[model samples]
Target: MVNLIYDKSPIFLQNIFISLKGIQIYRQRYNKVYRKELKILNEENEFNLQKKRFKSFIKYTRKNSPFYSQKLSHLKKEISMSDIELLPMLTKDEIREHVDEIVTRNKGLLPMGTSGTTGKKLIIYSHPYDISRRIAYLDYFKAKHGVKKGMKRASMGGRTFVPEKQKSHIYWRHNYILNQLLFSIYHASNENIIYYIEELNRFKPQSIDGVTTVIYRIAKYINKHSIELTFKPIAIFPTAETLTVTVKSEIEKAFRCKVFDQYSSSEGAPFIVENDKGYYDICPATGYYELERIEGNIYEITVTSFYTTTTPLIRYRIGDAVELFDTLPENYTQSDIKIKRIIGRKNDYLVSNEKGKVYSAILSATVRKTEGNFIECQFIQNKMDEVIINFVIEGVNDKKTIEHSIKELMKVRFSESTEYNVRFVEELESTDGGKTRFIINNLNRELS
Candidate 1:
């Protein structure tokens, strides 16, 4: 009777009903691929196979990729896989400057625009094969948690404004297409949340993915209202932003499910995935990653994606700082490497009050503990005795407690005489299309 009523309902109402059913069918198809991927992940000798694959990719990039070939011309030596570091790390600026030259003039390649946090956008081209590989990687990760393809996926991302009538319906037609209930991050608000939640309950997706900040906001609303949300997703995948411990906890608490963090970028490949054990493991099939230290122990991440043939970003300097749990080996596999933390961008650090000094991970960790829902934080040191802490917090809190905590934390982390002032304000914004930087230091004027 319910099926007959839904089938015979008015066009407007029928569309909603169809969308909800389509989502369920999509999840089932996705789950099958997920299971197959999990088996591959657990296979022995996978690391050795990945290493062999990487070596072959390096050779391919050196020959086909003009950007890499030009850079390697100076090193008049046999280019082995180990010689990857010898190549200069590519940056976003370089890509923008040499956009046409970097991209292979080939058909069946897709172009993607990266909306950087700084409002600077970069258009990158990728081969269709590369896109398929990315899908495979997602499938592999999802399978570990028993997520199926036919299940509906709600994405809290930028592209949700498309009208229901005009938006692509191929996903709905095919159960294996991974049905997406796209919710716009740009429009997330009280009213929007209510509508989104209601629609989501109707759609009942198996999982959700997208920016951590937007997801956190929705989770906050759900928790605040103490709403008994019936749409229990199998997993929540957060990408594009720094997934702090606090945000992760809150999200998990609200959704009552495990939260998986994915570390990826437009220039390179999806590099990291959190396992059931809560440890971030490198994706063996995607690319190779290395950490290079600039000052003291502060490191910058360099990635070389094997699958990026259209515009190979060889030894790409992603500009982000990271702390590794395991030191990379001369001939290492994915299992040999683990990331302890992503320490934000290299530019998002402050100079220490101590002469001839710098701060990175320690400072970020300190500010992260302060009382606020901050999108970004920066320390501005104009003089030896004074420092201004520019921050963006979501709502009201104990300012006195926060200030005192920051001051005490800074004292212990840096020089004692460095008195501080906390600037609490809303709208600590992001680069138009990029992740927010949690820490910024203006003292390094020349560097800025």
Candidate 2:
């Protein structure tokens, strides 16, 4: 049975419930033991450990799960990364189609959904074990940054804690259970922003976590208005969206604290965070990852979950891109995987004439699935009813093939009256964070 109460519960109560739930009890025990292992396990050792765990997981799925059993019936018993590569890539569409068959014979099943940066909502499954590890992953980084559990903190992501159209001074909801102050991002108007800052001052959270753009808005407001804060937070963790250099810099200056960025998905495949050493490091305890190069230096991240038993997301191709690092720093001899930048996930959007918003992820997936040697691509939307696709092609014998494919997909998803322009660009540009912006929507004004 699905419980909507837990899904919409305050973050603190949800965390408490996870610790007390049936399967989660064992998961908590397992995590208590595994935390010790995580301390000594270096990047290389963690890879080997996850490799062993992955093989076991595959065997478990093949014996029980109808989806994997049929998919891997022909493969040999000995599983290798190269051998796994031979298997068909799993997309979000496949999960939506085969959700019932993908689930394992496990209890404490939980339904989860992605924020849907790709235009379409993606529903995935998880269990107590998965949730435990996820919380632990963030806690590990929190500990590194001198943040402890039960401490005063504030979060201002996509959640609508405060309802819009309600004229009131209260712009936040207090969660006394976790000593957390939940701010609303939907009401980020000039008038509402003052209440948000006022609440932060009154509550005096030790740390703040929020969406990249939302937090940047608060920081920009502080700088522009010269609004003096009563208290300074120890650290700021920006998540959900790409963290640009300008956003990070402005946030650090405004809050007088460090910014720690992180990346992950609802699929529970791989957990990654900005380490204290200043690099995007994958949490070895979370899952295994295989990087598939889609274009020049830009690779699509494929992941397999090690924690979840209800859903086996093996070799799942999440529609996000990242840039690989060529060399490692001399001091960092522990990490095997080195990632310099995360280009971005599909989070761009388009607005219709009637103010209907369309996700950029829909367009990104369409072009990515096309059979062509496109080196790089970006979707730019300046007007409400128009779109410009800026793409870089290495060399294609039939350029018309690419154009036809894009237009064909566009026609199906968008209105016939919408104006579409395909522009062939020599090179795409990167953001201040040294990462490429896949979806650029200038119409959605940034914080001044």
Candidate 3:
């Protein structure tokens, strides 16, 4: 069988065999989810079907999950979609504290966890249904960009394929199963980045999928050195971190391809994708999304995954903020959900002593104008008055030039009283799950 060949074949032949098998498997799974999605999509009232699925999910969780049973006992008397919303929103702390009770009949479940960027990591189980549905949606996104399964692709993200300590020759690992050339973010540097460029040029992948930081760094290097790519990718996909305008522009210029931003989490609850129309289109089938307004045009997103029965995330309050749009734009492809833009997390803003609160866009613009040579940056704040700027230097710039530029930029954004510290680093580290955080704030102040 092809599956047997994929498992037992040597590395060289494995890419071909695995590509064939992966296509067949993805096709079967994609059709299953696609058929269901089409049924909901064609309906005159889609929320009516969503409501039914939500009720069934609530019943399944209440009957099997001990944690949900106790939490939803009050609503058991009169179950409805409106009543489900009345239940207390699930928090990451609650999930971490009662992971065992949250899981239901874990016979064929896979354990998973988040990157723990906020100092609280949630551990849960991945349901088989969730995995299949996720693959189907991923295929959908790739199809939109004219990509098919088993295509030669280059990926640079959080996975530690090459060990962090080994930095010299081997900067990449190839996966025969997916026909992918995996570039390690840890090993990307000035002395070693050329090897990554060489491997990418050698593979000539049709698509390059990676975190924004890694992809941006590679793109910046290529542009700076005026090195032309051997082969052009049809599309560039960015995930795992927030995609900024500056990075997106740089990446598009470097690759000479359109960049599609894909947003999802390990929790398997929500899915958002950048469509050809330049909109952050949301998929309604993945989760029931609810928005809580924090300020002007900014709302906190809370979601409940309809497919996650093993460890159901119902009304889970993930700390993410986004611009609000009540309706989708004209000529939009998808339906039922609308998000104007993702404004990073609640902690991405700086609580200035004078300017009230400054969002990531403001800080990003300031840094881009001042320090254009830095490939990547992270703004860290531990207090209201002090800000630390962490940057990975790509060019040979003196310390004083970089420091003075950052200080001048900070003065324009924050008050003159606010202190600035600039730290030059070799590379930024990704979280345990391979996600890179652009902004890290340790203070306990409320997000405005």
In candidate 2, what residue range of length 10 has the lowest lDDT sum?
Answer: 327-336
lDDT-sorted candidate list, best first: 3, 2, 1
| Location of the lowest summed lDDT over 10 successive residues in candidate 3 | 159-168
**Model 3 stretches astray by more than 4 angstroms:** 1-49, 76-80, 164-168, 325-337, 345-448
**Best-performing candidate as measured by lDDT:** 3
Please, what are the lDDT tens digits per residue for candidate 3 over residues 346-431? 46667667655554444544554464455566777889879887777666655678788879867755557888888887876454
**Pairs in steric clash, model 3:** none
Per-residue alpha-carbon lDDT of candidate 1 for residues 1-448, written as tens digits (9 for 90 to 100): 8756754555456556656665654454335544554455567355565677677776676677676677677774456556666778778788888877776546766777553433234568975556555666776678788786557788765432223333322212212234666665534434456766666677887998876766777787788899778878899998777787877888998889999887877656647878887767777667777766655444576787766768877777776776676556656644556677666544444554352233333454455545534444656556556767766555566666667877876764555666787787664434444544444444535421
How far is each candidate from the true structure, as Cα RMSD in Å?
A: 13.9, 10.2, 12.7
| Residue runs of model 1 more than 4 Å from their true location after superposition | 1-44, 73-78, 160-177, 294-298, 326-336, 345-448
Could you tell which candidate, 1 or 3, scores higher by lDDT?
Answer: 3
TM-score of each: 0.64, 0.69, 0.68
lDDT of model 1, residue 79 = 60
lDDT of all predictions, in order shown? 0.63, 0.67, 0.71
Error of 2 at 337 (Å): 3.3
